[model samples]
Target chain A: MIENRPLLNLISHLTLCLGVLVVAFPIWIAFVASTHAPEALNSGTVPLWPGDRFLLNYAMALGLETGQKTLNVNLISMLGNSLVMALGITIGKLLISMLAAYAIVFFRFRFRMLSFWLIFITLMLPVEVRIMPTFEVVADLGMLNSYSGLILPLIASATATFLFRQFFLTVPHELIEAARMDGAGPIRFFIDILLPLSRTNLAALFVIMFIYGWNQYLWPLLITTDEHYYTVVMSIQRMLSVGDAEVAWHLVMPSTLMAMLPPVLVVILMQRLFIKGLVETEK
Target chain B: MMSNLSLANIGKTYPNGHQAIHSLNLDVEPGELIVLVGPSGCGKSSLLRMIAGLETITDGELHIGEQQVNRLEPAQRDIAMVFQNYALYPHMSVFDNMAYGLRNRRTPKAQIRQQVESTAEMLQLEQLLERKPRQLSGGQRQRVAMGRAIVRQPKVFLFDEPLSNLDAKLRGQMRIEIKRLQRRLNTTTVYVTHDQTEAMTLADRLVVMNAGRAEQIGSPLDVYHRPQTPFVAGFIGSSSMNFITGRLDHHQLQLGELRIPLKQKVDFNGEVIVGLRPEHLHRGTDYPHRIELDVSLLEQLGADTLVHGKVPGLDQELIVRLKGAAPCEPGTRLSLGFHCDELHLFCANSQQRIN
Candidate 1:
């Protein structure tokens, strides 16, 4: 911006285009494969162009009765499960983390710092590291095939809580004092002032957390054994496992595209707020 | 309705055992504006906060309207505060900001609307009622803050250096606006500021604080003319009061080789400090007490000229404020006269005014 350099701009644009193509190449391949029949992709090297079976493949993937039957679950039900799990995780995490951060930052109770640090320590332990014990706890609690089993364990992470705590600390102390002088109690202050001020952070975190919940492969695969509890993301694996024969690449590709659709749509729709939230929260 | 507020031997010591405010006692009459003026860390703000119930009193009792409010919360204390930063809710509109208190108190919706509209009209913030705080200028934000406090209709108003954040011109304008508003409302108010000019202009009674203690409390002119302690004398006036150490002998004060007769006889005569205000020192040779000073620096402010110099044979520098411009170059000698009654005498050790 400071100096107009044509060659530098050219190089930058070229690099960006290359990065975009590299990222978009796989999705394009998936789309092409989904449009073709199983016989077209069974030969050496997958087809890179669409065939006449575009409507047939998507309809079979979405319909109750289809050409390939690896799993008994329908595409609509799997999509519904994914949507529910993502919404549950996003809302649950936001609720619990905001309350925890509020209590830790505003209240003067004993062991407040200890509690904050205990929550902060959870950042070091990802779900992948504690999957076995978490799954066992879910099974013991009989929440294995429910939405709570898919959402609650993932909501226990400290990232959102820490972000909220950092944000709450940056809010001017004078605002809190003024609210107190205005006859607003703690609940009123949180509802009237704190929540509205945190709108951008909430939106940004929603985008991240929704994608996190939607793209969960290992957790959903390990927890849900029932066909009705299958998320679109985990159902892709079930379609791939065709037992002692060639896999149904066409069906698997369409389901993969379906699994990736909602989160991609969310990111695209809230791109402005997502970018603003990300930048502001880092401050 | 207005109510008298009193602090009886109030004090604050932090948990770490650092005492920020000494036992401070003051009786604020109803509808009076008391300005607490001091340097930073002098506990003026702490005293204001304690009176507002934002800070706990570690020592004594606070009474508002004949009720002991030591254990009450800030909201229950019936006091509204205008903070230095304005503290306007960035997310709320100006109307919402002003109406927040009444809403919290569960006032009827119709009443809240009427009160907010009236207060906003008073502050001239009606046009900005729908705009957020961030959309307003510094002066507008300040008015919104005042509107927020005014809508509450509390018994007392607390201001913690509210004008410290504005620019010089806006501060002057807002100072007059605040004084006028307070006069119209007639609410018992406690305002805090480190700037003495603001304290002098806005306060009905000024409390000059130093080192966590009130050095003097009186009307602005009374404190300026008759300061009780050396700290009060030095802090109240601009450009500072010059003090000269000399020996008091019988009825005469001996300044090295210069001898000046005292109009009144004093009992104690060993060592004393003579205080002289800059404005009191006139550029003439006719007055009873005259001294020749070797001019060191001259600052020409359009309305008045500040002469910084030293008395002959004295190492201490003395400043004289002369009306209009006096184009006297440095290293020249000038004879200045001051009245005998204008001299302030303090004990050399205790720094307490003697005569």
Candidate 2:
């Protein structure tokens, strides 16, 4: 029984490594594809070594892809737009959710339970079921082609509120009492004591919201009809043509890789936050 | 203000209709450490929370230092609390946690540092100031909690079983530390604990509560030696006082085949509980109204023996704490003495102390 301990530890380590590789295979393959030329990719030559075309393909992918009419869709401008949209959603959601969660968790007002239920009820409804209605609502509000239409609906999701509410419930009544005794009115207590105590949840929620914002394709696509409003994912989708003029794997693969940069960087940079946040929350 | 502490007919009924505390009246002299001793669900903590402005009073006046604070937020009460869990803001360093209130009050940064350092030094927490709550020992965390209160230099200090979470040895040690610190600070402190030993050792005055009502408020010795009610006498002592139920036939305590003398004249009771403290039992003296008993169990401590036995027709049992070696053996009758001077008389019907 004792001899198996080292074997168990080894198995765990290897399993974790395998998990990382599995999650990362697509990115690695995409980067490998970017290194090859269009003919090499389409001709079905398996690329084993790093190809010389990486920088060349990157330069082309960084530029606007030329259409049959010779017009172009910008790469960097779309990235900036995507960033603005993501920031809007992430920050807006956090504020609304924090306030809502605080009010739900601590306050003693009328219809408190009812209000919480109303929010909880939203979790049962998928945005896919209401996409048409939501689109009409955005269009009617003249928010089409604007960031608000892209951000607002997504920002008001019940996840953060539910998550933060769970976190605040754990805050000892004594800490709340200590805050009040120290003269930290409700607002002050929420900000100074409760919020600081909730870093783990905040970090985890931030990563979740960031990935959701970055990977956005369908909603941003449905809402923004203009090329100028395209996000990174939207730009990559537009690169594929309907008629099959000639499929260039070189451009498409690099473009897909380019689209993943922000989310990848976010996950790596805030991995510590994301892990700690979720860990603290489990308590 | 009116006085250091006062509560006017305070009460609490939770939303679920759990009546945690009933109409409770209490007053405290300045710098008095009033320990509220009660069993679980007695509403002592709830009453303290109401005074600390953590909970709504539901109905009644809560005054601290002459100011009615029923409407005030916890932070506005000028009071500081040391909780059972310590609640030391686990994420914060000892310095920041202790200095948090001063900073909230907009004390100058230099002043905050000085005050926090001074408080830390007083608690012997200077070396541990850099550590978070998770890093400190339970006793150290308790001290930091005290430091957190002291740095505020608040009008009143409220402790809600702050030492209850510690180990038995640590609890005893911190109990002494807290009493010494309270004396040094001399601020009006109200402490709540269920431990009779704690209530006995630390309080300037004791408030014994039961079933959401204050049963008695007096000095520790006063509550122990001269409890006004049977409940107080029973609740305040470790082994608990025993009461023998009997009728006063011709004003004499009439047990079956046993007649006990009475020093106080009280109404004859149809039913009553007699209480005797273990320390009051003395060996080998006989007088009028001597009773015979058979011993069933004898528990020996280093200092005394607790003789447990049943007398005929008593229905229940009797315990006597005898000093040195006791001559009484199991299933054997030995002569022991009872003096009327040491007898406490209570009304058999109401269970109220008559003597």
Candidate 3:
């Protein structure tokens, strides 16, 4: 900037524009595809431009009975299911990770390090690798086809715990001592001091975890057998699995757009806090 | 209200077997400001923390008023501490930060408000009460930290280098402010700082600590003039004391080639280290003890001049403090004198005061 490198600045701008194009192109195609009728997309290389069937395709997607027997499940019900699952996972993970990190960092109980390492080891074993066993446990507990089966297992990851722990460690030891001098016990300190200081981290983690929970496909696919329990992301696959037809590209594309809307809105609205949280938690 | 604090043979040893504080004892009178001064790693902070109930008293008992408070939490000990960093709650308003303790105690809302408002007014933080700590200046934030402690009206006030984070000019101003506030509040206070100036200026009674033990504890002047140990003597004064190793004979002190007779008799006659303060050295030949020096360097401070040089056959460097600016060059010869009463003789082996 001091040297006024116009050429370099131009090059950087061009590179960023290209990156944006690469990411946005798919969503653009999905939008175009969702606006067309089934026959419009079935013919030669799918249409690049919007068609006249926008309301028709979306209406079918949100309809309780789409008139096609195979795709009878309502997109409205699936969206509701996704919202519940995302909120559950985000809140559950934040609470569990925060308390765990606080205990591990502040208290000097026996085997504290061992317990921390044990929780940290869960980072290595992702939910995907332990899917069958997790599913079995969920099934045995009578949680199959329920929201808990879709969310609880995925909430047990170590990423949030580690982030909270790292943030807690960076807090000055003096604050804790001062709080103690103020006569605040552990819970009071957490609510009064620690929680307020961690606002950005919580907001940022919520964004990441909400997206993580919303985009979950394989976990929800494995657990939820009942049509009423299907999340939007997993139910998209159900819509495309119509046996002999050309995969209802119009209906599937609209559902895909709807499925991605909530997380995108969340990220866009809370973008400032999200970036602050991300940068601070990493520190 | 103020209460006396008593520490009976208190000690601290970390879990790794690092003995940070040995069995230390001190008694604080009501409304007294006791300062614990030392170099870092000297366990002054550990001692303060133990008294605040932030650290475990591994060996002995601690008493505040009539209660044995060694097992009590910091809150239960009826103490409030102002940290070096000011430790104002970053997200809370100044009023909330001060009111947090009272709220935790379930104090009535009207009472909490009145106390917080009065403390804020006392610290002159009334206008900044609604501002978060980040919005305030360093000195303002420091006052808020003090307000937080003062609002509690605890039996004891603990300060752990609370002014160390300020600039030098600000530190001096805050030092006076803290002293005035402490006196006005009349609370039994224990302050810890490594700055000798703070220890000297603010302490009603000073405890000079070294390597986990109290080297000497007395009034500021008492500790400065009659230090019980070489460590205390060196640590208390602004300019370090000049020490000359020599042999002590019957009623006489023998330096390299000069034997000066003493005014008083001493018990031990072995080798001893004689300490003389720089200010005690005069430019004229009016004192009973005299020494000549070859000046190697001169530092002319506006009000006083520091003459750094060495005496013949003396291995250690000697410094002389002369009043005002002295027009003297390096490599010049000067004669300095002191009284026998100004001399502090310490045993060579034990570093304990001999007379």
Candidate 4:
């Protein structure tokens, strides 16, 4: 990269193109296949280009038009449920983590580090490991098949809390003292000073937690049996498990592409703040 | 309005059992500026924080005006502090930063704006009011920090090394600005700095601290002329006051073979540490006693020169500050003369000044 020789540039550009193809080829194949008729896909030769039924396949996938043996479950409502659960989880995680990190970093109390470590150790006990107990608790609270049930169990993230704690630690002690001199009490300091200072961090965490929430599969699948509560990811499983019937490749491909859009948009929208949050050196 | 501030037996001991400040006391009349000057870990900053109510007083009473503020929160103490790093709220605009305390106190909206604008104008930060702290230069940020403190009109203005973060030129400028602001406001101020020049130039009454104790408290000139402890004598001047072990037999102070006849009578005399200010020594036969110095090093500071060398009988290096450059080089012998009254004598063991 330091040398600007034409041959070197050509070679590097060719290698980059190859890398892109390696990563993007599968997505391209899915997009192309989603536009084709189900009949076109069953022929065993994959289509590499656009087909005539682009609108037809997408319409069926969105539950706007019904095809033969189409998915009886509503795709639009499933997408809505996914959005709600994703938003809820992202917001829930950010709020809980920010407060926990604030308490851990700013206040001095007995067993403070012990409580932080207790939260940190939960990183190892993700929802998969504590599935039964989490499910029992959700049921006991009568929250099964609800947005709270989908979000609450998965919202307490140690990584995000640790990140905020590290950021808060880097904030100079003079700032806290200055705020105290300005007559700002604890909650006032947190809101006026700490919150605005953490704008980029909040944006970055929102994107990450949003994607994390949107892609949740096992947790939703385990808890949500009601079709009204079905997330797009869990519904995809139901789509594929139509009792030994040949899976709807055309419908599934379009829905898969749709499922990836919200997270991609989130990343794109918050790309600037995300990078700033991750790499900022200034307070 | 100005209010007198007093500290009675102020002390601080960390929970880890490290005693940072021993029993210390000071009083400041209304509109007076008191400076706490000491080296690091001398508990100067800790003492200031205690006054501002940012740090809890371990065992003492602090009074601002008529109120005992020992257990009060910083907000309730009615004091403002300008930190070493200027500690302006990085996220808030300069105007908002200045107005924050006023707003917090539930001051009327129009009044807060008026106070902030006037403070900004006084600090010459009117144009920079909409800018954030990071957007401004170091001096501007420093002015904004001062502006923040001024807007509050607190009982006492506590500055914790406010100029230590600036470049030399900017620091000098801000030092003057801070003194002027404090004077115009006529508030009782407690300023802390390790810089001897800042302490000497700005303090109305200087407290020279050592090992968490107030070694001396007086006007800058009074402390300079009459240092009660060896630490104050050593700490006040630009270069330290040179100390040479000598014997005091009656009126004759002896450094090996050289005898300096004392003009005043002394009651206690024996092994004594003689302190000499470099500026008080001259390089000619103008005074009562003359000592020949073998020059070792020369520091030419343009305005003045420091001649570091050793006298024939004294084993320790003798530093003499001369106007402009000295004509002597290394290994050359220079004749230096000093007045008898210029000699500062202390007990060798106790390190207390011998009056």
Candidate 5:
């Protein structure tokens, strides 16, 4: 499709190289800040060079007494919380959404279209507004301060459902037909043909949903009152405000950097797979 | 060994009440390539789907070798299909794609690998086994699709316009390849295509379809030479058979004041269409089909020349095939002629063949 384009040819290699650096600036800042000492951060005399406080920051964030909750801000517990939330959401949502998408895209049902539209319209309603009612529902379920309370309400994701539905829609209806002719029933056909064909798309969605599940702040904060239920994002916010005289500059920087690492690494690693998956969809 | 496929009064009424296929009937003998050829809206694909059990037989029975498969699922039909887009799983390597069905059936790994490798070798896809579909060319992908089907070793093979996605040159190449493969396997193959050339060269018998119904079923040559219906005549040939409104009077077909020799004699012939193939026309004849035609255009395709010209009182210009290149200019006058036996007469009102 790009064969006839002479316009792209006119763009020079140097300009393209410059564009790469522009995108890398934020990532560079995260790493640079991560390697520095808390004193440099506290002095507000931003260092142009890497400092030797990497160990100091780590020590402060992980320490039990003054360094622990002051700078580190119980981030280890928060990291554990985020892991539970992300994994629970990713695995649970993928299964339920896939089943929903398969039925909507491939099978005959009385209210298939209506079900699709209901799910699709959920893509619009901001979760911010639904926090109160959703919190009430989670509380009514008696899941307060529990991991279920953290993961359950948002576990049934419309985004993953929508993405999987789109991917399933593109699967050549022939493959499903072929699977049907092969004497395979609905579940067998989905597992054998549709799932195998959809690996790339699924991987792409897994990355997207994993990041979203990991980074959720507002809902987790609103639902769980227990500090034990604090997710990684909430831990970062807590660390930034942990002190009276001076914020634990020591633990705050490293803990914040650590909190952001998983999602950043996820994006970096899965970006190639995501791009390849997108192109495959066009094919 | 081959399998018989029969569709008995199969009709598909979609949920929205669109009858995509209605009361379609077809029977296939073992080991024959049955080609379903038709226009876009025709339900050729639907009929094939019904036979394969990919689609439910809405109001009838579908039998594969005496088994009433109306309720049988697609996998139970014991048939494999080659899709139009080749539907080779995009992310899988060619070998994995071909081996998938056998693996699903729990054929041992060694046997599955051997079958897939052998099928790949046959399709000349050995080198392409490790490659993903995106890496392979269109023709290679098509071969991989065929390999996937062949590896199943099913009772029948269903092809839904398998070569439609390739370029003309590759399509011609793949058509020959597919026909040769089908001949070797002698599977009871049902190929659905709208391309007349594919239908002509590949089908042992052609099922010409229109609007969810079969129009005619016969050998490619039989459908071409003795078209039972006017649609078959117009569809089977390129430079589609010209339909000129004329009166079949005794012997000759009188179009306006011009007359062409038509050997058919009918009792009642008030209004009819004279179906003349482009190749059937001639440059010389004694009892000539002489018409004063203006050369609208000429397409010289190396071996033969297509003379596009208009006759007097006709709203549309017609095309005539000339053997070898003809040095004809636009707006020039030319005389065209043909024998009386070449004329195909059809009722102008009913659109059915007269002779």
Candidate 6:
């Protein structure tokens, strides 16, 4: 970037293009295969360009067409399920973590640091580590196969709590004293001052938690036996394994491409806020 | 409308058993400005915070108007404070920052707007009302802080070293502006600061505090002219007062290799710590007692030059203030004299002023 030599520029651009190709070529292949007819994909030579049956393949993949009765998995409802679970987990995690951080930081109580450390200790016990016990708890509560089961198990985030706690600690104590002098009660101060001040952090965390919720395959795969509750990520795995039958590359590719959309949209929408939250501490 | 503020036997002891303020008492009339001035850890700020209701008064009562506010929350105490950092809400616009209190109190919308706009006008912050605190300069932020406090019209205004964060010129400007605003409003205000100049200029009554106690409290001039304690004498002046241990016998005060005839006889004096202001020492033996000093360093302040030097036998350096660009060089001996009555004598053990 500093030196504007022709050779250096060409070399850097070539390296960047190669890196892009390394990351994007597989997604490009998936898009091309999703557009082609099933016969063209079964011919063994992968198509480099998109085909003419793009709409038909996508329509069948979305469960709108009556062409294939055997693979009649409705992707639209799965999309809705993913959206709900994502939103639920994002909002729930943000609310619970922000309140926990607020209590840990601003209020004085018994076992304060003990509570914080208890939450902090859960960072080591992720969903995978405590999956069996968590699943048992969810099953006992009769929450399995429900939206609450998918979202609630993943809602309490120790990282977000720790992040918010550190952010709140950086906030000047004078602001709280000033708010108190201004007759703002604790709830009012939290709503008006603390919430707005933490906007970027919230946005950044929303994008992350939403993506995490959207891509959840293991938990949903374990809990949901009903096709009605299956998320897009869970359906992708179900689409690939059909006992002895051949994999439908056309349907699977389009569904895979569709599954990537919501998370991508979220990132694009909150890119500015996410970058700002990570880079700068806005006062 | 303003109300008088009084603190009776106010004290603060932390839960960890460290006492910050000990049995402090003051009564500020409705329009008076009392400045508590001291160094860091002197408990001046703790006393101010106790009055503001930010910190609890461990032992005594605080009254704003007729109500004893020991149990009242800061909001219920009906006082506003301007902090050293200005403590403006960074996210809120200047207008919102000033209007937040009134809004929280649920004043009518139109009345809130009127109050905020008028307060902004008084602080000359009308144009910058839409700007956030980060967008404004330090002086503007300070004015916004002041405007926020003024808009509330609290019974007592508390300023916790409000102008200390500004640069020298801005601090001076804000200092005058604060004085003007306080005079116009005539609100009882308790201000805490470590700067002696601010204390001397801003206070109707100055409280010089040291080691968790109010060493002296009086008019600035009264405290300056007649400091009852050695700590007050040392802390009140621009340049610290110099102290020298000397002997006082009968009507004669004897320093090392120098003797000055006393103007008035004291009843009892064995060993006395003599206090002298730098400006009190004049050059060339014009009045009475003369002392020959060896020059060590010269600090040339424009209007007055302070010559720091040492006498032949005294352990401490003596500074003499000479008027207007005195062509004095460092390492040059100068003869200086002071009047007999200019001497301040304190008991060496108790450090209490004797004469």
The deviation in Å at residue B119 for candidate 6 is 1.3
For model 6 chain A, give the 10-residue run with minimal summed lDDT: A64-73
At residue B84, what lDDT does model 5 achieve?
89
What does the lDDT read for residue B317 in candidate 3?
94
Q: What is the model-wide C-alpha lDDT for candidate 4?
A: 0.90
- Fraction of native contacts (fnat) of each candidate: 0.86, 0.62, 0.79, 0.86, 0.45, 0.81
Ranking by DockQ: 6, 4, 1, 3, 2, 5
Tens digits of per-residue lDDT, candidate 6, B172-272, equal 99889999999999999989999999999999999999989999999999999889888999999978898899998886788988887787878656899
Residue-wise lDDT of candidate 2 within B129-228, one digit each (tens)?
8998888899999999999998988888899999899999999999999999988888899999999999999999999999998999999999988887
Per-residue alpha-carbon lDDT of candidate 3 for residues B207-318, written as tens digits (9 for 90 to 100): 9999999999999999998999988988888689998999998878998977888887788889999998999999876787778899999988889999999988788898
Candidate 6 residue runs with Cα over 4 Å from true position: A1-14, A66-70
What lDDT tens digits, residue by residue, belong to model 5 across residues A100-216?
898898878898899999998888876787888888888889998999888888878788888888887777776666555545678877776778777777778878888889989
TM-score (0 to 1) of chain B for each candidate:
0.98, 0.94, 0.98, 0.98, 0.94, 0.98
- Candidate 1 residue-wise lDDT, A183-233, digit = tens: 888999999999999999999889999999898889999998888888998
Better of 3 and 5 by lDDT: 3
Q: Stretches of candidate 3 above 4 Å error?
A: A1-3, A64-71, A281-283
- Pairwise DockQ winner, candidates 3 and 4: 4
DockQ, computed on Cα atoms, for candidate 4: 0.84
Interface RMSD of each: 2.7, 2.2, 2.8, 0.9, 2.4, 0.6
lDDT of each: 0.90, 0.82, 0.90, 0.90, 0.81, 0.90
Best-fitting candidate, scored by DockQ: 6
> Which candidate, 2 or 5, has the higher TM-score?
2
Worst 10 residues of 1 chain A by lDDT: A64-73
Clashes of each: 0, 13, 0, 0, 9, 0
- Model 5, CA-based lDDT: 0.81
- Tell me the spans in candidate 1 whose CA falls farther than 4 Å from its real position: A64-72, A281-283
Per-residue lDDT of candidate 6, residues A45-109 (tens digit): 99899999788888888888556643557889999999999899999999999999999999999
